[model samples]
Target: MTLLAGTWDGVYRTTGPRFDAAEQVLDCGRVLRVRQFDAFDGVFAATKSGLYHSTDDGDSWTDLDVPREEVYSVVGSPDGDRLYAGTHPAHLYVSESGEEREDDSRSWRELESFQDLPSREEWYTPRHRNEAHVRSLGAHLDVPERVIAGVEVGGVHVSDDRGETWEERKDGVHDDVHHVLVRGPDHYVASCGGGLYRTRDAGESWTRLDDSLDQTYFREAFAHDGVLYAAAARSSPGTWRGERGADAALFESVDDGDSFDVVEYPGHPEEVVLSWTVGDDTIVAGTNDGGVILRDGGEWVEGGRVEAGVAALCAL
Candidate 1:
């Protein structure tokens, strides 16, 4: 499924050039984030217009009840007991039915304490509005008690008690977090506007891995079997209004983001690669220029374009 970012075409599930509507109706707005939790057998999408839920994979989706008008990130607990939604202006809302379901039966409760994190007054976006937004949310597979929220221009906020309390994580490090991928209790990667960072001590310290690449603007990243894949551009998306578009470079780190080398593809994304999905033996990348490239058998292949820009892609 492709979460269209450039227009209100909403989300679509595609098989090569053929595609089908995945949302309830038209003009569902641009989807900023899409997450799938196997524990719940569900998929959630945070869009500019509203939030959505899908139970039977990507076949259908319905708008879920949310208080905010713009949501940036959505993630579920490891046990599927609770669902978390992060929205614009950096607000966090949670719902818990103690059981996972397909509909909006769970009661959502806002966690106002999230705004109390450190240096919140310093959070400001340079290109757009001054206020920050929660762009990425993550949870450890083994350690269910620990969760994290990556707020753009606001640094990282971690909760050890499942979002009951929060603490800011940043020291001698850059913020503007774009995405966070938590693998285990101690291993995680933060794809930030500054560069790619990885923490082995659970956010205690982050080591910048892009000092050599010189491509610091990182948006999307994923790690599997100790191999890390990331999308890097010269700058952020908000500043990409030039006629030249963007210069996105794909990189792979064999040592868990300690170092990276460029990877070539068929339709090398001249724009930013903002979405990534890993299949059984394939890895797919979606670019800001509405390009979808797949890597299988060590060769890159152009799948197709969504025409509305691909922000998020997941195997359903």
Candidate 2:
């Protein structure tokens, strides 16, 4: 399987043997997220400028005319036809069904009255209009009707009606949810600002599980096989005492999300750990500066080094 990574310098691609780099510099200032539409054949990258699609594996890219340029996440249907892009100020864009064009401005929907919902004030405190930043989106693996979204400064939002309506599912969850991962029916976990939290009741309630991870910015979480993995980055610590210990860490939980054991590394401690994907039993952890490493039986093996840093890793 091939993995795609987007960074400030450019876009990168990796397979079994070689690491290829596509110099798609972030002239627009920043690139928030990146994803491959179909395996490694096509990629969708979001930056301050706008959304871009690379069908030729980053050799060339085309701008996707999303409403807002500050897109943080993008997800395509399982078939890679229907595309959905989420951005700051709470905007959603749907591609013109089958049309994919650079200047093609499709119909866009803005979620404005979210704070008017019943649980708005309680769940989304300091309810600012553009603060409901949607960071991540995932289509349920088994359920087509359920669409999960992760919002910054706000808890998880579940849309059982296919993004038409959303409800705050933070009953037992802490605020400042950053990422969400769905494993099965009730097996789902969220990575919040404080740490990682898991809920068997979908998201009605949650229990914090970030004691082992020393991070105030839990960026992403993923599950493969029977193991659950989470990435923690020390962006802004609660106190200055923990500033010297600021480093990224990747944790693995074999018995679901109950407890975790640190996947030790030989180099410097990691910082800003991102997403990962598993192949066979080899778990790969993408970090801000430490490149990628393969978690073997009981050790972490160096995968390789990247000059632009790793954003997300997914197996095609």
By lDDT, who's the top model here?
Answer: 1
lDDT of 1 by residue, 41-101 (tens): 6677788887787776566667777678798898888887778888888789998855334
Error of 1 at 265 (Å): 2.0
Please give the distance, in angstroms, between residue 207's alpha carbon in candidate 2 and its true position after superposition. 2.2
lDDT of 2: 0.65
- State residue 283's C-alpha deviation in candidate 1, in Å: 1.0
Worst 10 residues of 2 by lDDT: 17-26
In angstroms, the error of model 1 at 236 is 2.2
Backbone clash tally (model 1): 0
Relative to the true structure, candidate 2 reaches a TM of 0.81
Clashing pairs in 1: none
lDDT of each: 0.74, 0.65
Model 1 lDDT, full chain set: 0.74
